[model samples]
Target chain A: MELSGIAAYLVSFFTFVGIYAILALGLNMQWGFTGQFNIGVAGFFAVGAYTSAILTVPESPWHVGGFGHPFLVGIAGAMVASALLGLLIGWITARLRTDYLAIATIGIAETLRLIIANESWLTNGVRGMSGIDRPFAGVFQTLGLTSAMGTLIVVTTFLVAVYFLVERARQSPWGRVLRAIRENEPAAEAAGKDIGRFRLQAFVAGSAIMGLGGALYAHYFGFLSPEAFMPLYGTFLVWVMLIAGGSGNNKGALLGAVVIWSIWSGSEFFMSAALPDAWSGQSGPLRVILIGVLLQVILISRPQGLLPERAPKTVPFGKVANRKERA
Target chain B: MDLLIDLIQLSIYGIVLGSILTLGAIGVSMIFGILRFAHFAHGDLMTIGAYVGLSFLVFTGAPVWWALPAGMVGAALTALLVDQAVYKHIRRTQPVILLISSFGMALVLRSVVQLVWGPNVYSYTGGIQRPWWFGDIAIVPNHVWILLAAVLIVAALHLFLTRTRMGKAMRAMSDNMDLALVTGIPAERVILITWILGGMLAAGAGVLLGMDSRLTPTMGWNILLPVFAAAILGGIGRPYGAIAGGMIIGLAMEISTLYLEPSYKPAVAFVIMVAVLIVRPQGIFKGTL
Candidate 1:
C-alpha cells in the first residue's frame, strides 16, 4: 500500500478512537460521577445516528430520510433526540433505584432496535438508510485534506471540545453535587442537593454527548443501519472502555477507547485471517467471550481502570464499599 | 361470537406464555430477594439451558422431556461457576457492581451458546403436533407440557420455601438480609442455594420456551425484557408475586395482538413497565427493596 493509504488508515483509526472516546466520556458522567447505571448506551447512539442520518440524508421513497440537510444540523438533531430520551429515562429512573434504570435502559434500547427494524417508513425497515455525507467535504478540498483526514480533524475537534466541557463540569459545583450523590445519595440529599434533579441533569447531559458521538459516526461512516449499533459495539464496548480506562477520568476514558478499540479491531483482524472460512462466524462470539472475561478480570483485580479516577475530596459512605479510597 | 372465540384463543395462548414467563420471573424474583440485584444475565442463563437440553437430546437420544432436567442441571452448573468465579469476588463490593458483571455475563453466556450451538435455530421435535382443541380454542401439545412443568415446579418451590429449613433460610435471606444474618443463617450457603435454584428455574424457563417455539442463540435474550416486566409487576424480590405478574403480563402481551402487530409486543411490555415504574415502583406486591 502507498504511504497515503497508510496515512488514511491511521486517520480512520484515530477518527473511530475519537468518536468512541466521546461516548466513554458521556458514560463517565452517568456511571462514574453519578453512579447511575445506563446499559442502553446503544439506544441513544442509534437515536443520534438515525436522527442525523434522516436529517442530513437525501429524501428517499423507502425510509424517513431525504431532507438533504447540513451535517451540523444532523448532529444537533441527534444530540437533541438522544437528550430527550435521556431526560425521559432520567426522569423515570432518577426517582427509582439504580437497577430500575439499568432494566429500563435495556428495555428502551431493545424497543428502539425493534422500531428501527419494524417501522419501515421511519428507518426503511431492515434494508437500512445510506448515502450520508461527511461534514463540509467539498470545502476541505481547499485545505488539501482528504475526506478521511477531514473527518479525523472534525472528530478530534469534537473530542477536545467535549473533553474540556466534561472536565469543566467535573470542577464545577454542579459536578461536585453529582459526585456527592454518587458517594452517598442520602447524605447528598441531607446536604440539600436535589438528588433527583442533579441525577436527571447528569443523565441527560451524558446521553446528549453519546448522541453527539453517534452523529459523528453517522457523518463519517455515511450509512445507517441497526446492525451498526448492536449492544456489543454501542453499549458494552463503551462501558468496557470507560471502566478499563478508569471511570470518572476523562483522559482515561480517551485512553481506554484508543487502547481497547485497537485490541478489539486487531483481534478481529487476526481472527478473520487465522480462522478458516468454515469457522468464520464463530470468531465474533469468541471475541465477545474474551471481552466478557476481560471485564470480569478487570472487576476482580482492577475495578478502577488503568487510570484511577482522581476523585475530588469528599466524605464517603460504606453502603456500597468495603474498600473506600478517599481522595 | 367470532370475537369471543378470538379472545378465548388468545387467552389460551396467553396462559401458555404466562406459564413459561412465570418460571423465569420466579428465578429473577428469588435472586433479587436473596442476592439484592437484578440478574441481567438471567435470560442468557435460559439460553444456556435451552442449548444444553438440545445437547442432551442430540448426544443421548433422550426424549424431549428428559432434556428438561438435563438443561436445568446444565444451567445450574453454569450459574454456580459464574458466581464462584466472578460474582463471589465482587460480593464484598456493591451489589450494583454485581449487576454490571451480570450484564457482561449475559453477553458471555449468549456468545457461548452461539459458539456451542452454531447459531442455528433448533427444535426439540421437527414433527408438528396437532393442537388439542375445545370449540374454537386450540392448544398445542407442547404447551401442555410447558404448563404442566411450570405448575409442578412452582408447587415444588412453594413447598420448599415453606417446609424445608434450607428453603426457609432462602426466604429468610430475601425477607431481611441483616436480620437473617443476625439470626445465624449461613449467608454463604444461602447464596449458593439461591444460585442453584435460580439457575434451575431459569433453565426450566428456557427449555419450555424452546419447546414452545424454536431454539436460537438469542431466544432467552429476546424475552428477557418481558420477563423483567413481569418481575417488576410482581415486585422485584417477591417470588410468589412474580407469578401473578407473569400471568398478567403474559396475558396482556398476547391479548394486545388483537389490536397490535405482533412485532409491537415488546413495546407493549416496555410501556407497561414504564407505567408501573411511574405509578407504583413498589410493584403489585410489596417489594422487599
Candidate 2:
C-alpha cells in the first residue's frame, strides 16, 4: 500500500480506536470505578445497533421509511435503549459474586446474539442489515471530502466530548462513591451508600455510552450482523484495552484502545501479506494465539497495566491556606 | 404405554447426559472449592481429556475399554502438568486474576488443540453396532455403557472419598485449607490428588460424550456452561450436590427441548442456574468458600 493508502488505513483504524475508546471508558466506569465485572458489553452494543438499525431501516414494521431521522437521534436512541436494558440486567445480576456475575453477563451476551441471529424480522437474521446512512454525508459531499474523513471527524468529535464528560465525572463526588464501592463494598454500605442502586446507576450509564459507540460503529460500517458482536470481540477486546491502558484513567483507556487496536490490525495485515499461501489459512488461529500470549505477559508482568491509576495526592489544609494567602 | 416408554427413554438419556455433566462439574466444583475461584477452563479441560482419549484410541488401536483407562491416565497427567505450569504460580493472586489466567489457559489449550487436530469433528469410537432391544424403544449399547460407567464412577468416587486416606485429606483441605495444612495433612499433595481425580473423571466423561456424539474442538464450549450451572446448582464444592445438580440440569435441559427449540437447550441450564443462585445464593447444598 502507498503512503496515502496507509494513511487512509490509519484513519479507519483510529476511527475504530475512537469508538472503542468510548466503549472502554464506559466499561472502566463500571469495572474500575464500581467493581462490577460486566462481560455482556457486546450484548448492549448489539442491542443499540439493532435498535438504531431496526428503527431507521427503510420499509420496516417497527417504523416507516427510516424516519429520515438525523444520525444523532439514532445515537441517542441507542444509548437510551441500551441503558434500559442495562438497568434490567444489572438489577438482576449485580448482587451475585464476581465469578457468577461474569458467567451471567456472558450468558446474556450469548443469548442476545442468538436472538439477533434467529429473529429474522427484527435484525434480518443472519443475513444482516445494510445501507446505513453516514452522518454529515451531504456536508462532506459539498466539501469534496471522503466519507471516511467525514466519519473520522464526527467520531473523533464525539469521542473527545465523551472523554471530557468521563473526566468530569471522575472528579465528581459521584465518582468518589463509585471508587469507594470498588475498593470496599462493605465499607461503602456501612457509610450509608445504597450499593445496589449505585452499581446499577454506574452500569446503566456506562452501558449507554457503549450503546452510543455501537450506533456510531453501525453508521460507519454501513452494516450490522450478529457475528459483528461476538463475545470474544466485545468482552475480550474491552478487557484488553482497559487492562492494557490504566483502567481508571480515561486517557489510558483512549490510548489503550488506539495502541492495542493498531497491534491487532497491523498483525493481521502483516500476517496476510507476508505469510506463504499455504500458511495463510492459519492466520486467524495465529492471531488468537498472539492475543493469548500477550494477555499472559500483561497479566504476569503488570497486573496494574502500563499507565496504572494514580492515587490522588492529599493536600494539607495549612498548605492550602498558606498558598491562598500568598495568592 | 408408548408415551410412558418415550418418557423413560428420555429420562435415561437425561441421566446419561447428567452423568457426563456431573463428572465435569465435580472437577470444576473441586477446583472452585479448593482454589476459591471458578475455573472457566474446566470445560476445555474436558475437551483436552476427550482429545487425549481419541489420541490413545488412534495410537494403540485399542478397544474402547482399554482406551478409557489410558485416556484417564493421560488426563490426570495433563492436569498435573497444567497445575504446575500455569495455575500453581498464580494461585495466590486475587481470584479474578486467577480466573482471567484460566481464560488465557483455555484459549491456549483450545488453540493448540485446533492447530494439532484441526477444527473438524473426530470420532473416538469406530462405529459400534447398535444393540437390538425389546419393545418399541431400542437402547444403544453405548448409552447403557455410559450410564453404567457414570454409576460405577460415582460409586467408586464415594468409596474412595470415604475410605481412602488421601481422599480424607482432600476433604479436610477442602473444608479448611489452612487448618488442614496446620494439622500436617500435606495440603499440596491433597490438592494434586484432587486435580488428578478430577482430571480422570472429566476425561472419562469426555470419552463417553464423544462415544455418544461427535467430538469437535468446540464440543466442550457448549457443555462448559451447563457444567458450571450444575456445579453452582449443586453447591460449589460438594461432590454429591454436583451429581444431583447435574441430573436436575440434564433433565431440565433435555426435557425442555421437547417444548422449545433445540437451539434453546443451553439457555435452559443457564436460566436454572440463575434462578437457583437468586433463590439460594449458597447453592442448594449450602456450602460457602
Candidate 3:
C-alpha cells in the first residue's frame, strides 16, 4: 500500500476504534463500575445512529428527514435519544436481578431492530438511509483534510472527552458508591445510598456514551442501516473489548477497543485473502466463531482482563485523594 | 360469526405455537431455577435441535415426526457437552458471568449453525400438507401431531416430577439450594440432569417450531424473547408456570394479528412480558421454587 493509502487506512481504522472505545467506556460504567449486565448495546446504538441520521440528513421522501441540522446538533440529539432509552431500561430493571437487565436489554434491542426494519417511513426499512455526509464537510474541505482524517479527528475528540469524563466519574464519590453497590449491594444500601437510583444513573450515563459513539459512526460512514447495528457489532464486540482490555479501568476500555478492533478487522482481511472464492460466504460465520471462541478463552483463562481494575487507594467517601488516582 | 371463526382459528394456531413455546419455556424455567441464570443460549440450543432434527429427517427418510427423538438426543448431548466444556468452568464465578458467557455462546452456536447449514431456509417436507377443515376452520396434520406430542411430553414430565425420586430431587434443588444440599442431594448430578432435560425439551420445542414454520439459522434466536416472555410470565424458575405463560403468550401473539400487524408478534410478547414485570414482578406464580 502507498504511504497515503496506509495513512488513510490507519485513519479509518482508528476512527472505528475510537467509536468502539466510546461504547466500551460506556459499558465499563455500567458493567465494570456498577456490575449491570447489558446485552442490548445494539438497541441504544441504533437509536442514536438513526436519530442523528434523520436529524442531520437533508430532506428525503423515503424517511423522516427535514431538519438537516448541524453535526453537533445531530450528535447531541443522538445522545438524548439514547439516554432516554437507557433511562427506561435502567428504571425497569434496576430493582430486579442483574440478569433481568440482560434479558430486558436484549429484548429492547431486538424489538427496536424489528421496528426499524418494519417502519419504512421512519428509517427507510431494510433498504437503509444513505448520504450522511461527514461532520463539517465544508470546513474539512477548506482545511484540506481528507474525509477520513476529519472523521478520525472528530471521533478522537469525542473519545478523549468521554474518557476524561468517565475517569472523573470513576474517581468521584458517586463512582465509589457504584463500586460499593457492585462489590456488595447490601452494604451500599445500608450506607443510605439508594441502590436503584445509583444503578439507573450509571446505566443512563453509559447509554448516552453509546449513543455518542453511534452518532459518530453514522457521520463517519455516511450511511445508516439496521444491519450496521447488529448485536454482534454494536453490543457483543463492545462487551468483548471491555472484558479483554480491562472492564473496571477506563484506559483499558480504550486499549481493548483498538486491539480487539484490529483483530476483528484484521481477521476480515485474513479471511478474504486466505479463503477460497467458492467458500466466501462461509467465512463470515467462520470469523465469528473464531472471535466467539476467543471470548470464551479470555473468560476462562483471564477473566481479570489484560488490565485488571486497580483497587482505589482512597477509601470510599474519604476526603484525602489517593495520588494513584492520576494513574 | 366471521370474527368468532377468526378468533377460534387464531386460537388453534395459538395452541400449536403454545405447545412449542411450552417445551422451550420449561427448559428455560428449569435452567433458571436450578442454575440461577437466564440461559441466553437456550434459543440457539433450540436451533441446534431443529437442524439436528432436519438432519435426522434427511437421513432416515421417515415421517417428520420421527425426527423428534433424534433432535432430542442431539440437543441433550450438545447441552451436556456445552455445560461440561464452557459453563462448567465458570460455574464457580458469579451468575452474571455465566450470563455473559451464554450470550457469547448464543452467537457462537448461531454462527456454527450458519456455517453448517449454509444460512438458507429449509423445511421438513417439500410440499405443504392439506389443512383439515372443521366447519370452515383449518388445521394442518402436522399441527395435530405437534399437539399430541406436546401433551405426551407434558404428561411424561408431570409423572417424572411427581413419581421419580430424581425428579423430586430436581424440584427440591430448584426450590431451595441450601436445603437440597443439606439433604445430601448430589448437586452435580442434578445440575447435569437439568441440562439434559433442558436440552431435550429445547430440541423438542425447536423441532416443533420448525414444523410450524420454516427452519432458518436464526429461527430459534428469533423467538428467543417470546420464549423468555413465556418463562418470565409463568415465573422465571417454575416449569409448571411456564406452561401457563407459554399458552398465554402464544394466544396473545396470534390473536393480536386481529388488530396489529403480524410483524409485531414478538412485540406482543415483549409488551406482555414488560407489563407482567411491572404489574406482577414475581410473575403470576410468584416464581416459587
Candidate 4:
C-alpha cells in the first residue's frame, strides 16, 4: 500500500515482537531455569488479558474498572491475578513428574479457554470485550505522537524494564537455587532447598511477567477476545519460542521470539501473495504444515537450540590440590 | 425412580465410553511400562486408526465389522513403522528427549490428518440408527457391540499375557530389559511385539470411539486429556490399573455432567487427576515404573 501504511505495519510488528519477547523470557525462566515443562503459559496470558479487559471495558457488570483507569494500573492488576493463579496451579502440579506437569498445564489451559468462551456474564462470552481506551491517547493527540510511535514507546519501555529485571533475577541467589533445582532436584533437596517452593516461586514470577505481556497486548489492540487466547496461538507458539531459543539464556529467548515470529508473520504474507489461484485457498493448511516442519527440523537438528546454555567453569580439583600442596 | 434411571443410563454410557478408554489406556500403559516414557503420540495414533477405518469402509464398501479389523491392522502396521523409524532411533536418548520427540510426532501426525481429512468430521458407520427401548433408557446397537468388543479384547489380552510365550517375554522386558536380554528373550523382537499389541489396542479404541461419536481430526486430541488422566490415575505402568482408571474417569466425567455443565467434564477429570497426583502419586495400582 502506501509508505505510511507499511511503516505503521512495521511499528505494530515491532510492538508485537516486544510483547512476545516478554512472554518468551517468562517461559524461559520457568522451563529453562526451573525445569518446569509448563505447557500452559497461554492460560495465564488469557487470564491477564481478560482480567484487564473485563475490569476496564466500559459498562461491564463484573466489578467496574477503577473508573477507566490508565493502562498501567490494569496491567498491574492483571499481573497480580495471573501470579496468584500460577501460584495455585504450581503448588498443586509442581511436585509431579515432568510429563504429568505438562498434562496438567494443558488441561488447565484448555479449561481456562472453555471458561472464557462460555462464561457470558464475566467475559461477554464469545462476543468478547471491546471499546478499551488506549493509554495516553489524549497526550498522543496533543503532543503529535502517532499511534505507531505511542505503541512503540510503551512496549519498548516495558520490554527494557522486564529484560533488566529478568537479568537481575538470573544473577540473584534465587536464580541460582532455581538453576540448581533444574540441574538436580534431589541434590538441591538434600542441600535443604524446598524444591517445590522454589519452583512455584519461579513459575509464579514468570507467569506474572507473561500476564504483563497480555495486558500490554490487550491495551495495544484495544479489544479482548477468547479466540485470541486459543491454545495453538498462545501455548504452542510459546513452546516453540522457548525451544527455539536457548531456553536458559535471556538473550536467546529474545532472539528466538523475534526470529520465529518474523518467520510466522512472513510466511503468512508470502503464502497469501505467491500461491497460485487454485492452491491459494489452501494456504491456511500450508502454513500449519510449514510450522510443523520447522518444529521437527529444529528439534532433530539441535534439541538444545542454536545457542545452548554454556556450562559454568570451575577450577579443576587436581589443580586446586596442587596449589594447596605447593603452598 | 427417575434419578435411578438417569444414573443407570449415565452408567451405561460411561461403561461404553470407558471401554474405548480402557483399550487406549492399555496401549499407553504398556508403552510406558515397556518404554519408560509417556508417548504423547498415542492419541494421534488413535486418530490415524479412525481414518484408516474410514478409508476401508469407503473403498471396500465393507461391513463395519470388517472395517474394524482393517483399521486395527492398519494401525498395527503404522505403529510398527513409527517404532522402527522414530522410537527405536531415540530409544537410547534421554527419557525427556523421547518425550519431546513424541510431542513432535504428535504434532506431525495431527497435521497430516488435517492435511488429508481437510479438517472435517467423518464417520465410518454413517450414523447407524440406535435401537431405542425401555422407557427412556434407550440403547444403541453400536454401543452393545463396543461393549462386547471391549470385553473380548480384555479377555484376549489377559490370556495372551498369562499363557503365551511372547506375552511372557513382553512382561520380562517390561520388568527388566537387561535381565530379559541376558535371559535370551530377544529384547528388540519383544519390544516390537509390544508396540504391535499396543497399536492394535489403540486402533480398537479409535474405531469404537468413532462409532460412539463422530471422528473429527480432533477427536483423539479431545480424548487425549482423559486418556492421560486415566493412565496416571490407574498407575502409569499398570495395564489393569489403567483399565480401572479409565472406567473411573469415564464414570466421573459422565456423572459430573449431572451436577455441572457438560463443558466442564474434562475439567472434572483434570481436578481429579491433580488430586490423585497430590494424594497418591503412585496410583491405586502397583506397577514397576
lDDT of each: 0.92, 0.81, 0.91, 0.82
Q: Which residue runs does candidate 1 get wrong by more than 4 Å?
A: A276-278, A312-327
Compare the candidates by TM-score and give the number of the best one. Answer: 3
Lowest summed lDDT across 10 adjacent residues in model 2 chain A is found at A60-69
**Number of the candidate with higher lDDT, 3 or 4:** 3
Task: Please identify which of the two predictions, 1 or 2, would achieve the higher DockQ against the true structure.
Answer: 1
Q: How well is candidate 3 docked (DockQ)?
A: 0.71
In angstroms, the error of model 4 at A98 is 1.6
lDDT string, candidate 3, B1-289, tens digits: 9999999999999999998999999999999989999999999999999999999889889888877899999999999998999999999999889999999999999998998888899998888899999888999999999999998988888899889999999999989999999999999999999999999999999999998888998988989999999999999899999999999999999999999889889989998998887788778798952
DockQ of each: 0.79, 0.54, 0.71, 0.50
List model 4 lDDT by residue over A217-271, tens digit each: 8888887777898666787677777778778888888888888889888998899
Q: TM-score of the candidate numbered 3?
A: 0.97
> What is the DockQ (computed on Cα atoms) for candidate 1?
0.79
Error of 1 at A281 (Å): 2.7
Per-model TM-score, in order, reads 0.96, 0.92, 0.97, 0.92
- Candidate 2 structure, TM-score to reference: 0.92
Query: Ten consecutive residues with minimal summed lDDT in candidate 1 chain B?
Result: B132-141
Model 3 clash count equals 0
Per-residue lDDT tens digits of candidate 2, residues B239-269? 7899989999988887776677767777888
